[model samples]
Target: MTTQNDAASALLDTSSQPTNLRIAGDWTLANYKALKAQTEALVGHYDGNTSVDLSQLGALDTAGASLLVELLGAQRLGQLAETATHLPAASRALLQTVYCSLQDFCVPEKQPEQSTGVQVLARIGSAVDTLWQDTKALLGFIGLILETLVRVLLHPKRWRMTSVVAHIEQTGLNAAPIVGLLTFLVGAVVAFLGATVLASFGATIFTVDLVAFSFLREFAVLLTAILMAGRTASAFTAQIGSMKANEEIDAIRTLGLDPVEMLVLPRVLALLIALPLLTFLAMLCGIVGGGVVCAVSLDISPAMFISLLQSDIGVQHFLVGLVKAPFFAFLIAAIGCLEGFKVSGSAESVGAHTTSSVVQSIFVVIVLDAAAALFFMEMGW
Candidate 1:
């Protein structure tokens, strides 16, 4: 009753009794498609009395043995396989092997969900860990810079004067105009505020003292440091990060030159020189802007404002602000160079570290300035 094609491939007998599935024909890869199609809806049909008959089964392979295992269901196959001594030894072995392999197949369990508070706490912990790592990296980089710098300084023949001078022109001279203009505007605003507030108390003349004291001791250095943080810090990171991305830093190392000495030292030296000089210029420009505001708004002449400035604000106040400049410069340059070395050799990494350098430099400058302010206040300087 069977066609030759049906008899050539695997076949499942549906005419058998309800508890029985009879397999026949060659159970090999050549018949896997027809076998799978036949077994799809009939698999997992297990009642306690269910049975399988392989008495008429023909040539078999792993592919067809797997199909037989699925047809009988794994549990019943366990019981029926031991007593299937009438089956071909090879067929019994193949079925046992396939059953053993698939015995553990099962669905996986879903993970439990977490509460929102736990998620937030995890994020906070991650941030704190990241912050601690950054602090350690910054400190380590600072130590390397100092050690390399001292060694280079001792051997003046190895000094990179040309590079240092070029950077000074770039980070200092080029930025002078903007630093002056912006600080001048801020100074004018501060003076106007002081004058307006003092006028109500009939002490408008003391506005000269307010401008001189603020600009000389705080605003001048603070503004210059902040400006350099955004300007110079970003520039250092981009320059060094680009070199890192291009593998130029590796080339420097390959050539037996220290990257910290050849690259970082020049920048740190340039910024150390540049920031203090810029701070001085910022002080002069700020005082001049305040003088201009006083003349226009308070009807105070330039001479009187200068006299009040000289009398009320001593040279000590100027020194107090200037002393903080080198510290801020060193930290900013160190941070930029450190972040630059951290680049993972991609354009996006360069940009990300550049941004990170600027933010860290600014944050560090503000914190150091505040600490310096407090220290100087306590010292009565």
Candidate 2:
């Protein structure tokens, strides 16, 4: 049997030989060499295998760890009991994590089986069920919003008066110029078309009636709604989607603020108030454009155009346009806010919802307009 002194000396001699411990980070090679020399001498005095103390190591890196991993055969020695109990928990944990990652890099995991027809159908069914559940959730969300609105109406002190007023101004006043310009252009086109057709039939005087009827009864409201759908709807969706992506909505909730109250309510109320006003302004600009066309092109004169419009078009035309305005307003606002709330907190989601908001609003407005037209026609309007 070897004497303890001889064994210790042999162990010390073996350990004292410089062996690389592939470590990395702010340590010089000379520092690593010195540490290895000291560690080797200590290890040689004891058992041939011993845990190296890294607790006092001021710095380390992957280069150093890679060397250590190679020396220790991390697979075989990573979990061995510590010879030194004073090793830092941080250093040990770091080493273990690095070792595990290295193992993963060396070996890829097995893949799951590919789906068959039956499995694909099963997945689709599950997806449908999930979608149905989400639909119910979205409806419930809208209900909660309406309930909040009712509660606020019942308790005025709970409402933000300044915000509501500001929203109205934005939805109404800021939108006025675009609404006006679009309607004016539409009216000019309509008047030109009517003049060309009527002039052929020697009925050029009827151009005023055509302009008045189309603009007041249909074009103004429809164009205004579409504009709002494109402008305000996309803006609302993009704004809310950004907030969702940044986790600002979560922060608001944590702060006990209802995002619906802060974000959706103002927009909805603003649209409800603004759309009718915009419609009326659109009609005015359209008539003005028609008058200009008649004056220049048809020699009908602005006074004659206004007189004919007044005599031929009844209050019913204005009433119909205004009636559609509020409905379209509510539709645009609701769809925009709904799509915004649907955003999934990703960059792609923001763009998708913004597009969806505009598309949905336009579809709804057109559908509603068609239904309204059918109703008006049936009533012999």
Candidate 3:
């Protein structure tokens, strides 16, 4: 209550058999530090026989009242406030309030430590729950995409040819050079390594068969899909996420437009058409690269490499790789667009969801490819 610079004092007389604790001076915030120090110095005098005299106590505020309650202890606060006829009504009320509040306060209990096994189990359970949720989301999105696709297909006028063509240029044509270059380099490496290992057994010529079978059956589509996942998927997520963050998506919805149709369909259709073409291009590029390496390193002419591939590699190998393209493309495009729609209207949300899209697309492509490969192998394809 008082703003005066008067330092509060708590005096104790330990000379008598019973301690006498006296409080005096302005007990406001400004004197809190001094008063605290004084009380702390006389803490040893707190015993059952101690008697408090607050008659000389000056102005009091909540902060000082709190300190007084602490010095008197909760057990004696109520009784002292009631008996202290010299203390002002406001001061006594404040002391009682602080004392009651402090008595009711409780510190939260610390959690017990878990055993290693318990921690591990908790982590596994959490992972399973997350996986289940993700699976449900992906499946639901897929159904939504399928429904929209069917509706569009039924209405020829609803076809987004311009958007589809534009997206194809962006996702496929623009991507061809990098795809070709990577597959060519990887094919060369595969051919060279195969020749080196085969030479030990005097079968280096069979390197052509190794490269042909590997690239046509696995490398071409797998590599193309993985690249698209990282490159094209991230682009789709970022573009859609940016649009969503800018409220363009909401505007589209308000205008009676389906965002999935306006934004997602073109991208999905374009990828569907583009990925198969890219996979085919990848196959041709890979074989040529292997042929080049064979012509240079093994002294096997290009014609000879072609002849070997024609005889040793069957059409089924090519079909096996190309068949996986549509599935991969669908998943990659869907996952990318799905993540974009999930952005929470922030730059950081856009970034996090973009990264998540890439990871999910790549993982799905690889897993589906593996399962397809296993099915083919089991069926003697």
What would the per-residue lDDT of candidate 2 be over residues 294-367, giving only the tens digit for each residue? Answer: 99999998778878977888998889888999889877887788888889989999999899889878888999
Better of 1 and 3 by TM-score: 3
lDDT, residue 279, candidate 2: 93
Q: Given candidate 1, what's the lDDT at residue 240? A: 92
Q: How does residue 339 of candidate 1 score in lDDT?
A: 91
Q: Candidate 3's error at 257, in angstroms?
A: 2.9
The list of candidate 2 runs beyond 4 A from truth reads 1-142
For every candidate in turn, the CA RMSD to the true structure comes to 6.3, 8.3, 4.8
Q: What lDDT tens digits, residue by residue, belong to model 1 across residues 1-381?
A: 111247533333445566555667888999888777777655444445655666778888888877766666676666666777888888888777777777877777997888999999999999999999999999999999989988988998999999999999999999999999988998899999999899999999998888888988999999999999899999999999999999999999999999999989999999999999999999999989999999999999999988888778889999998999999999999999999999999999999999999999999989988998899999988
| Top-scoring candidate (lDDT) | 3
Per-candidate TM equals: 0.77, 0.66, 0.81
Off by over 4 Å in 3: 1-5, 9-30, 42-69, 72-105, 243-248
Instruction: Candidate 1: give the clashing pairs.
Output: none
Model 1's lDDT to the true fold? 0.86
